[model samples]
Target: MSNCSGESNMSDVLKLAQKFNCFYLSGFRTSECKPFIVQGFQVGLIRPDVIKQLLSFPEVFHFNQDCVELNPAFRDYDTRSVKVDEVLKELKTKNVFMTLKGWRDECYEVKTQFDTPSLLKMDRSATCLFGIRNYGVTINGFVRHPEQGQCLWFQKRSASKQTWPGKWDSMVSGGLSVGHGIFETVYKEAMEEASVPDNLLKNLKSAGCVSFYFESERGLFPNTEFVFDLELPIDFIPVCSDAEVECFEILPITECLRKILSQDYKTTNAPVVLDFLVRHGVVTPENEPDYIKIIELLHVPLQTIYWHRNKIKENGFGANEIQGSQ
Candidate 1:
């Protein structure tokens, strides 16, 4: 990529994870955000602007000093989904919210836990407005080269992508949308984004998942990415079969880390790949001063934030305690 100079301004690898989960770096005193309550559970952390806009639909949203909550009467899943969808559609017609302008026609299940049933589904792009807990899969495609050692595969996102256009990303990345399971998303993205064949897909190994709380100009991203490592034959090369990727490259670990730290790299996937490096021994506790801190940043306790509502309420959850739950 013309944008990459193979230079990184980041002095410590921990900085990458720190940047991703910046919500904690703020001293956990988030007075600007509001809790997005669903079915008596706090599902997302709503931003100030979004909260103001959501309050406009008084019939759909009600607020207490503690948080902004959905209508309690819309009890069932289907009813909540329909009511939220209707509001999202109206918001789409207006250009005030940039998130609605980038709608993918894809919906993300809004829930307290990934294994639990969804309370409702919302447009993927608009989920940020509510600081929704999003799930996705990230695969690190690699090969043990005879001469070059282990190298990682990277994809340049399609320039036309709504978010992070033309940025360097994981070999294969896909979201666990409304109906897709974790491994199912992995295979689906592997084929569509990198065209990895079935034989190589068998090598896909689940390393674990990385969770972080990120806030961007768009919204809060409490993302948990299930991580996988796939070892391909040294002779194999990736071919992009989908419009999502512009091209692919295979770079050794050192160079791959630099690419990750580059400005063109996706911030959300940084912790994902770093977890892979930590597991593969590219980054180690003996060598890196902040190795343990990086690990903590990659595994934020997002899954239990909603599950332990009382922990938050007792904490006096400044800013609705969603931000403090970190």
Candidate 2:
């Protein structure tokens, strides 16, 4: 709860939703009310009669004009029985999985056993329709100097990457897949992306989670990133073992901040680095006019999407895999 001191020049940084072409909906954008009435609200796009065909399975969604609302009852049924995954797979086969803009196939998961259940399993590819929440890991690898201050290590994603190709990103990042634990995924991504050894991995600090919801050409991306802070040796250099990264660079904290402000880093990477700068005193509350807003942007409320993780049964899948930093 401490405040940062710098007045940030990145005041024009895009809002989470606007960065991805999305808007919150309590009601229609126009003055007229929507045709069908529903209790709760949803995050989605104004597509054609797409929901009409999907409504055949009454338990999945309720359609109103061009808007589609996820049925709350789908959560009661088991994963396979609800057939949400099966339906999406079929849709993909028929080329119904159209992208309004460009495309990316970054994969993600949908847990139907949670609150609202319309689509069972959605990946990075199909999130546009329903705005499903996705989880991942991001590590801030840095080195401290007694006199010169802190330096951050950044990676340039490969030009071939499905999402954010050729953009500067956090030192390490990867999706939190269905069967992996936080620590396990961290270890895997660090080794695969940056070749970080287990010796250094043992020193990783869990800095908690950052959540944000955005809409992109692919779809609505509701993301929660489990952020880790790792203090690496000053001379340690990172080598990319996987084709996911194009190269690596170590920049002074100021350079990193400049890149973020200039929009040189990937869209999501800005918030992660901004949080770091604020926490480390690089950007203080006094200097940054939007300090409070930046702080709030990192922790969006995800109670409904995250509830099932707490209700896991003894025999539940990946139950043993869920835990804190190793």
Candidate 3:
């Protein structure tokens, strides 16, 4: 078999993560309870037995007939103020694989908006500490050549990267931590990854977001990425300023397509780059029959889960206002 461009299946790579409703790949299992409604959002799902374990942290979470939720009392508290160490420690002591060591230090918050009050806070490494959604960002850098046309810049990840080591990735990408805004993160990541100066960073255009519900060995990853398109000058070259990227390469748009189709790009980044190509008219229905499917795959129906939760809350159907309600 020839491992070449046309031989690879783009649909296989571009397909949205399989979803059981708003949740991903969760088959109908009686023991598995519906997802929890945290401040009117489907933050995560838990088994009935897991709900019992979470009850120990009464001030941190509330339980109802069908779901678990963040205790309303903590809405006004600092993201880190709601203490969850005891519950996490209990899960860890119980040998829950998701709560194991080396994943519990950097704090992460679950909030509807960046500046609004947080619904819950936990360690970044503990996403599966309890399955919840986290947001990130990916920035694409490209240059328009008079002769070669549009070309994209890709980074070869450092071998030491804890996740997806030694893979080709977008020009810049990073997790949107609790305290940072979208643009702030873009500037920081751009400077760190590709040495793009602030003056150049100012030209970045908001390219909306790409969302997916991914299941990994670590746990469920219901993620949304804010995408940015950066058009660099043709004469500009990217320099690696961080250890995350081993090196950088600028390739013609056609070669970029070949590399991505050949599975040379990281899994998450492939979709992001594909989105960029489609939006910029590089991939069109005339040339690629699957272009429409590729565009749809970049967005999943994650909002429906939260919308259902909101509607339920509007009908006066929710967890009891009292702390630790049965």
Off by over 4 Å in 3: 1-33, 39-41, 47-65, 71-76, 79-81, 89-95, 98-104, 113-116, 262-264, 309-326
Best by lDDT: 1
What clash count goes with each model? 1, 16, 0
Query: Regarding TM-score, does 1 or 3 come out ahead?
Result: 1
Which residue segments of model 1 deviate by more than 4 Å?
1-10, 307-310, 314-326
Q: What global local distance difference test value does model 1 have? A: 0.84
Model 2 C-alpha lDDT versus the unseen true structure: 0.63
Report lDDT (Cα) of residue 262, candidate 1.
83
Model 3 clashing residue pairs (backbone): none
Error of 2 at 210 (Å): 1.4
Model 2, residue 193: displacement in angstroms? 0.5
Better of 1 and 3 by lDDT: 1
Q: Give candidates' CA RMSD values in order.
A: 5.6, 9.0, 7.2
Candidate 1: Cα lDDT at 179: 84
Ranked by lDDT from best down, the candidates are: 1, 3, 2
Model 3, 134-225: lDDT tens digits are 77888989998998998899999999876678999999998877787788888898889889988888899998888766655555566778
